[model samples]
Target: MKKILPGLLLLSAALSCTNKNEKMEPYKWPDAKAPIADIKPFTRILHGDTVVDNYYWMIDYFKKGPDSTKVVDYLSAENKYLDTMMSGSKAFREDLFKELKGRIKEKDESVPVFNNGYYYYSKTEDGKQYYKYCRKKGDLNAKEEVLLDVDEMAKGHPYYSATGFSISPDNKLIAYGVDKVSRRQYTLYIKNLETGEIFKDQIDNTEGDAVWAADNKTLFYTSKNPVTLLSEKIKKHKLGTDAKQDVIVYEEKDKSNYIGAGKSKSGKYIFIYSSATLSDEIRMIDASKPDDAFKVFQPRMKDVKYDVVALDDKFLIVTNWNATNFRLMETPLNQTGRENWKEVIPNRKDVLLSGVDEFKDYIVLAERKNGLAQLRVRSLNGPEHYIDFGEPTYTARIGSNPDYNSKTVRYIYTSMTTPISTYDYDMVTKEKVLKKQQEIIGGYNKEDYVTERLFATAKDGTKIPISLVYKKGLKKDGTAPLLLYAYGSYGSSMDAGFSSNNLSLLNRGFVYAIAHIRGGQEMGRYWYDDGKLMKKMNTFTDFIDCGKFLIDQKFTGKGHLYAQGGSAGGLLMGAVINLAPDLWNGILAHVPFVDVVNTMLDESIPLTTNEFDEWGNPKDKEAYFYMKSYSPYENIDKKDYPNMLVTTGLHDSQVQYFEPAKWVAKLRATKTDKHLLLLKTDMDFGHGGASGRFDYLKDVSLNYAFLFSLEGITK
Candidate 1:
């Protein structure tokens, strides 16, 4: 498993500045995170072990809690993974605990948490639920404690599954949602963490996110109860007593009772964003009481819809529509018992506000333009200036807790290209410093690999951007094996970044390319619109175009090309293989959303009806006709297709395992020839395979091996 040390060691100490309000400059990237970044095939650290490039991420030293140092060391050291090493859990946990006991003084028993980072995990065998908690044993990397026994909490509730929960700022009050399966409604409950006292009587079905009031005398949360046909009702829970006071803060009586309430750090006003299915709006409400005195802050342009991010108590930053792309605007909030408003930052067409966090004197915004996200800071006192933190080597995302403190300006920035690192920037000094960077067990070298951006036109004449990476000196001849990856659905953007395993593929002379297709927001909402509903066929055609483009550009031969995509993108891969399998040597479909017509037509399906907007509703005869035309599973025909590696998870809640399971079964049963089709399911994980990082790497490696097998690369 990959053991990335705590994020302290990965950051390069460098500072650069730029003008924020000045004319935009071309993309100038920063230095690589590592100086000697050769494609690290493996890394060995601390304990006696080794980690392979493919499966290294499975070891999560961060989960070890405060003193993750030892966990990191153990993870940095490679462990045995032979048949003998695959013993039962008890022995494995015992051995791990024993090895860690010397470094971690805390005597908590070892427990396995889900590696996806979602607040859900189950045992390997029984699939019983467990919760993650921590104890401060003076070790920053304190051992994590997993509480598995939920029989008490599950009593009297048919929907004993955990829904949503929040721990109070002081870590005292724990509020959680308990869904009742029959009513299809979720009830909220409160528990005192310190006393271990449960207040079940205070449970109510209508509550959503629980927000603590300024005085802490009452808790406010949004709810839609009493079988309301109107808007969601907001309610208050008075602490200490088994009482719930219901108050209708806002009501629309519309089909969309969707309302989200968020309290500003100052505690004077609460920002409420409400929308139906298509568009959304942001408004403000008085935190003190329920009244018509609530004021709505409408966008300057009604055509320009938006979402709000509270930059500070007085200013609410908004992301507004700029054609298909989104632009950011900030307006000051006047919660003075009177309706008042003013704009702080007007809309700028050239830049997209990618990040924002409020500080003592300034608000920081990381804006993206021309495929690059830059950090810029604006002060109420001084002119706004771009914090020339330098263009990150990869796509950078900035975020921070809403609690406005002196240190709140220091934001946690992470990228798919770089390890998660924390940085502190002084609003006063206009200076920046790296707080932490992730540690790599293996050494690195920069000159060993290269990345480039290329463009290709789709069958529909739309230009598709592809990010290409491979060893620096690979010849342009159409001989090298190529891996074409695309996830062109759900408005998701596949960003450019550094991948430890992908780099391994690059080092192995395989050209890795990401096809920025129609369904993603890379180009904007229109791009997504073009690939969804009846337009879904464009996604596959786009992939075909990309593969053909690769051949035309002489990047690789038709026999050396492989196509890969998962989830919605899996649908893309399956469709492309069906329509033009000759273009690819092999196909890797992971947790695919392939059975569209049947699945989307059924209202009983988990995500079917809700996703009708993204994928056309198959319930309608017209939509059914449209979806059937492109549904991969339904459209599968007896033809010569690429060798396929089909991967799925038994417990996938999003795209059910039955889809892939049934698709593979049908393909195997119906296909005419010996086209090799492998169906691998990691019975443990859900939509994400294998719980740990290393486990996921193993899955990916096996998948790559399967594709490479088609190219005669595997034994």
Candidate 2:
């Protein structure tokens, strides 16, 4: 049996003692009333189901209606309530922030990447919020030319993102994009590197990437829809011409498909890619011919997704045509069609061919086997071999290998106990050199920590992988606190990567574990297929099972186990709490997508149409009921619930702020428990809070403080 702390034991007993028919005593707090959102009583009749929502008006901020002020005011009230309730830990939060921030090396420089006759890198100075993008010509010892000083450029802006630095083929000019607001809509600007002159031409609402044509005077970029913020059109622009007159090279007809323009690695062709959840199409034109129309490489096919990579005489395709696990196929440049594609690397049942990095003489394939990443180097006409990571479980992916003529390939490797390390491997000589490893300013010792890969059997008989890390002296008596985390959606695998911030938890005797659930591609394509759409329930159940497994193994007691997830994972947190309300001691949901049915039903919302395949179209009736059945917001009942700290940003473009805000409003009014249900909203930021490096640590510190306060740990 697991030993439980007195406070946790009391909380658990209160929940276990509560009966469904009786009103349970709410846990007493610091004597502050949680925000009560005004009831508007909105009715929705969909698929023969009648639903009335009291906090539906919370979405008025996005609608820009009269209730917009009310929405903001309500959010402010919740923020104030959270502050007052957690006021006891105010000083602790600040100290925790400094401790987290102190681990980072204040002055840092990235490994310079050699591209197009220049070695480019970004370096950050101590105390600066951002970095300076600089490049050296010929070699590393050459004079440095600072392209963009983002620290200086972000002077007056609260949220500024500078990205997509595209240098012209001639290397005399450069184009970049900037977003002052956190909405992800970037304004493209061109600058003359030779004379340091800022051009008058500017393109607005672009996806940020600017693909330069061989002529150096023309550029191609993807434009986004103002409302949905979806990449909708590819346009061509001349150096000195007005953006209004830019020609529309191609426009995506299907709202589900996102389109983007990019140059081939060989610099021989400019390709426009259109992709959806299960389908893809590519169009290409010669880089020298900017005025020429792009020819279709492959027509979009249902349930068949493929990506193209250009080479000297052939184009490689990574596709799922007949293979559930993707395979590599190649076709001649002249015959760019699916019919002409010949299998270069046949599909294997065990290994998933994720991607390929092309080069002049060698090709590096990124493969995944048994839920771990691997890099395979293959010579065009020679032998192939997998690069040994020397670890049973770790993530290894092909990094930057831009120069086609270089025999060496760059790859990144990291494990739960290992810091992220970069390496350059000679594909021909089979030799590898470690370029750099992440430096933790406050010394770290791998020997002081223990990492383990465990398996938890799900209810459906599937073995779910769990990656965990803790301090060396961990006891299996279940007295320690454990935090289980996962993001089981979009085929995104939550691999075990090192985090300096996680040291704060491990050092405090908290066992941090990642549940490699079904929805992720960790176990290959079948794993993802079994956890999405109608089978989405597997995701929630898998996470619940993982937590139970941890408890069964005496890792932690149910009252000491905490759960966390963000975005889609937040949905997981919400669902798990509803399905197994008494299972977790505390939950931290970051920008949670709790309102699933309503958000999926509304096509006007950004990313809704694009996600129809992932979540299923609710208009079909079946998906609507299925989604509502597990939706966190819809399933909230008058029951004892775990303490939760829900966070969101006012300008969140991904999972909108209204989802969490409304969910919290409903939870406060509905839940019987008085456990901490605090909602922290970053009013100035969006989905990803704090653009600055040190600023994000503050949010992390607040989260740590919440967990510490619950466990009664104050440093």
Candidate 3:
């Protein structure tokens, strides 16, 4: 994970001149007292320790709809109270939203992807709330075929998502899934592109993806368990058959493992995968023989995770078996066991073999070396080369290339200061053609902004990476308000990509930074290992250290520093406030999993069983005590905490809305300071708050407005 570059870490300390138009006048917020929820006393005995939970009744609201329980009433009350308190910033929020919207090219279309005989793409109109999926035959100039008008489909609903637009191999039929309620349980629908006829066979509670068989009429789809929402079954359905008659091809009895099915690029076989956090098993089925039983290619083994793809007669496997950083191997189709797996790409302790994409004569591998994405193209017999992005710091990844016989490889590349650009590269000729770059409707100059890489020394002596970007002349002068963000769990690296929307903050003198903490594999697999289970607190501490490092460098000082994180990162915000309440003036926590102990202890919860490996199973004595020590809800104290704005969705399926609802309630009751503490719950959406593209910006505007309100900014 270590590599050397010349002078990549140097940042100039020039001060940017303040804009007159960005100046603000202080405004007084209406004096109001926040609502206080009545807390009923409750207690739980775990590992011989007595825990008292005053807001325990919040869980009941999750089990039942908000309408049937007092939870909905409490959430509504909180929303009303927050709206009233933030009334002074309403117009500022609107102006911010408008400015954000103006940056987007309203009538924008995606780059067309060629598959089979059609070039397909999705476009959004100026006034539409959703995309319109369309395609053309033979050539780009040919007459267009409207596959699905999501705008028309989402017309009457407050929340609507259309997913998995998989076309049959025969190219005559389309299979897609729709979810009106954002709980993510989609209903499958089949449409005949030739006749424009919609079939009546509807499959409910599915994962929204379908893998088509060689026989166009038959397809395989994964189903979700009703309670936990985990994908657990794969079933085969005939195009014209009733949903009740679909055959259950495979059922995963292990509740911790997630199951899904996909068709190979060769279109010769369908692969079904059952995966847990540390183990995985894959099975294969011949696409031509639709009714044949799947054969297990590898048996499930603990801590030996692998993914499979097929060539003509051999299977390429990417696995972590005996390879801490992962590697690529190949095995004959008939000899599908570990002993028969021969190394294709030797394991490099410093590089992570992320994934593999196959073509007729070449294979594209997505690897991570030195915390940066490296896309490599290797020929079957000729040569191997890495695509040069020609930038010091940026993100580049393999994009859509569905045709197995094509020589062109599609990829996307971008950075904190660069617009998202797409390109098609010729594997043989090494020719790169630019397809498109997202048009920031209002004029945007890349030279007006600058990005830099910085290192923060953690208490453990590990150097953490921080990606920062700001207006060109921003100085390291302890004056500009900084918004530090990090999500240091699940090994999910937060990519530092360009966003026209974020310019609203940059132009307003806010420095944005992403902390590449230990929980992310950005520095390799060991980086993630250092931040999970017993060492989970490192994720929180690293973030605090990064914030201080920025201050030490004079980017921002005490009380002027601001932080934001959602979900797991929200937990970061919660933990930091408890550990160091003097660090910031205000913070935002969205859909936080603050009640970690209780949530993890209950096996019935949606993500509980599946995440046992990440956050240890609390049933064990050692694990129970370890998690309870850092859980935000249990760590609340009677001291001053940072001013906070917490948001959640009433229908959130992942981190239940009640987690934040309960945390805020406990904070209000325990803390002595009269700082602003607000909760805004969206009554319509789920874990991902808004379904519409433009509508979600309003939430972003609200968060910005909340920060601006404290900073004395006005519209």
TM-score of 3: 0.96
CA RMSD of each candidate after superposition: 15.7, 6.3, 5.5
In candidate 1, stretches whose alpha carbon ends up further than 4 angstroms from where it belongs are 1-165, 169-171, 174-210, 215-261, 265-277, 281-304, 311-324, 327-350, 353-356, 387-393, 405-420, 619-622, 682-684, 690-694
Clashing pairs in 2: 652-687
Superposed by TM-score, candidate 2 places the C-alpha of residue 552 at a distance from the truth, in angstroms, of: 0.8
| Clash totals in order | 32, 1, 0
The local distance difference test score of model 3 is: 0.86
Which residues of candidate 3, in runs, are more than 4 Å off? 1-27, 65-68
lDDT-sorted candidate list, best first: 2, 3, 1
Tens-digit per-residue lDDT, 234-315, candidate 2: 9999999999999999999998888899888889999999998889999999999999999999999989999999889899
Q: Roughly what TM-score does model 1 have, to 2 decimal places? A: 0.67
For 98-211, candidate 3 gives per-residue lDDT tens digits of: 677666666888999999989999998876779999999989999999999999999989999999999998889999999898889999999999998999979999999898
RMSD value for candidate 3: 5.5
Could you say which candidate leads in lDDT? 2
lDDT of 1: 0.56
